[model samples]
Target: MSLFAAETRIVRDQAGRSVRVPANPRRVVALAPSVTEIVFALKQESRLVGATQFSDYPPEADRLPKVGSYIRLDLEKITALGPDLCIAVKDGNPVDVVSRLEMLNIPVYAVDPRSLDTVMAAILSIGDLLNAAEAASSMVADMKGRVSRIRQLASGAKERPGVFFQIGVSPIVSVGTPTFLHELIESAGGRNLAAGDTPYPRFSREQVLALAPEILIITSMARGELFQKVKEEWMGWRELPAVRNRRVHILDSDVLDRPGPRMADGLAQLFDIIHPDLAGKY
Candidate 1:
């Protein structure tokens, strides 16, 4: 048997690729912020030796050895971490980087968590990888319970508001049907005006104004003054129903954007904003 044979086990990742990962990985690297969040959710943070840039949720992740950004990984930094296993996101992590890690005999388990449903699956998969199956199951159950409650509350709503979710400021970007933002909007009893084939579609101010969104939600990575400025800009468009009704709100990009435990929290927040009447009752 090879030197690693006894210490590792073969398992299929979400990408359908079989990986030989350490039975008890003492040194693991997270290739994406979402992956880092999942490891923390499973209480497996101790196993993580490295994490990509912007894995700042839970605060503790910010202290881990940085292996560069998810899109632009630092191979040398990752290698120096001596990670026995690396968890990667299918859509975020560069394929070449994952391939190179595998080539170097570092097992890479790629997880594809596109929506809320798949996020749960990724959590379960990662939990199994880290020998935290019980924790993963508990977390997933909590997420499901929260979602069920939201759906039930949303069903009581008298009307669904048209929501325009702005993620980008320059050139104006909005999410489409395949995105988590769209799912959150729809789940929270709001219609996503940007729903279409394009995952992240660029929108002109005129185009958005024509749609006449009832609720305009802008999620920003920036803080304080910048976000307030963006909100003020939208408020200037008096023709918009969102602006007239004062339904324009700023959302924290981290809570909703990342496919992790906090997604449920984001959904709850969306529900409250989309249906304030029902929110007070809850």
Candidate 2:
């Protein structure tokens, strides 16, 4: 027998659950966009037999058969694909769905990349599962190098702006300390004005006005027209420092919202926004 002939191995997922998965998962299904992205990063996209509807990055992902959304998965379709393994994300995939898949004897590997460090770990773990350790290590090294450079640049900044990231306008939802966005904000030398234990917190207009953030960031999946509309609403808040100084910015939700390989790009964008003067320099 080969040195590592075991066809299946026991691995602990991010949720601290022991799962027996194929040592080399050739037929894989990604239950979340982030998970799909990681597989693509590992150069194992050909192994993906199925993926969620939101797994549209890398362009090639959109061509794959979609099992359904992360929350409302099509178990039948997923099973029909005859995948040897299914990769899910902690926050993206519903717990009940994972349980259902498990009951059906599908090997589910759950990953949670809530923070920057954990994000790197998730990539490494996925690589390990897919038997793409070298690719995963290379990807991680590149990511670390990029992040280290950003941190080195950010450390010398004299002042960190107070940034307010707006997720929703109607209910006024904002990112808190528990989410990756909050960590990205801090890492890019900006302070998240929304202070709460909740990953995403709702704040009243009065509360936001009180914080008086020096910078405003808006997240949107829509393009020019919708972005213009959202920007117009914030324009009315003339008293806000961001409004007065025109520091308000709009970012594509895909970059910041999805925790994946593109996170380095997201961090760079945040760094540029927080410290515009140090843009080309970095």
Candidate 3:
């Protein structure tokens, strides 16, 4: 396939916008961490000349030219990169930024992978756009296989423990039914106590106590004193089942927060934490 082929294909992005992209783009930029991860997963990172500051996965991505962040993109820097293609995420990358890129005649492919299935689809779509269909398909298949094995193992579990996933400590933020984290919790054979229509809901201490989650998984993005403090505060709820049973767990936010390839690892970790008996089975 010629990189400068006179061929173009129209595709619908995650934001439901139609875009015409090059048949084989030589220069690309990603505006979100998840998008950058997908590009690396497809082994097409060589074409990625620019990325957001938060695109720190794969380690090498950190060395790329910084294009500001998802919320605030450096238009001049991105323009100077002369990218034929730009990847964005519907949830993280703002619509105005994507619009600005499009106004500058840069093709933008936005993706929204809010669920496991959608995440796999987003990888495949990106692969198709980058002309790495085979690699993308293989990666998606591997991810699906891992998730299926976990599902099989979880199916045999006699009980599904009630789980409370803590994302923030101050306002007590948690994942709700509309988010991928909720799906991950269910896939790991745990019932999310914060399941609701809201994507990220703030819960009160009294509400959490009433819900009575058997397991408390804290995704402390920070480390050291802050992480210790969050756990210490939860420890004060001695009457809670998770605290009483010593099932409070502090997990890495990178794996849990980013909707990318590492999500499979996060799911596996959740399974292990929630059901220790099924450890090493999947």
Q: How much lDDT does each candidate structure score?
A: 0.91, 0.89, 0.90
Candidate 1, residues 1-282: lDDT per residue as tens digits? 356533988999999988998888889999999999999988889999999889998899999999999999999999999888899988878889888988999899999988899999999999998999999999999999889889888887899989999998888999999887899999999999999999999999999999999999998766678888999999999989999999999989999999999999999899999998888454
TM-score of each: 0.96, 0.94, 0.95
- Ranking the candidates on TM-score from highest down gives 1, 3, 2
Off by over 4 Å in 1: 1-6, 280-282
Model 3 earns a TM-score of 0.95
**Cα displacement (Å) at residue 275, model 1:** 0.4
Name the runs in model 2 displaced over 4 angstroms. Answer: 1-6, 221-224
lDDT of 1 at 233: 94
Q: What TM-score number comes out for model 2? A: 0.94
Lowest summed-lDDT stretch of 10 residues in model 3?
1-10
* Candidate 3 global lDDT: 0.90
- Ranked by lDDT, top first: 1, 3, 2
Put down candidate 3 lDDT per residue, 119-153, tens digits, no spaces: 98899999999999999999989999999999999
* Residue 22 of model 2, lDDT score: 81
Task: Give the backbone clash total of model 1.
Answer: 0
1-282 in candidate 2: lDDT tens per residue? 343534788999998999999877778999989888999988899899999987888899999999989888988999999888999988868888788889988899999898888999999999999889999999999999988888889889999999999987678889989888998998898989985798889988898889999999998655567777888888899999999999999998888888888998999999999999998465
Q: By the TM-score metric, which is better: model 1 or model 2?
A: 1
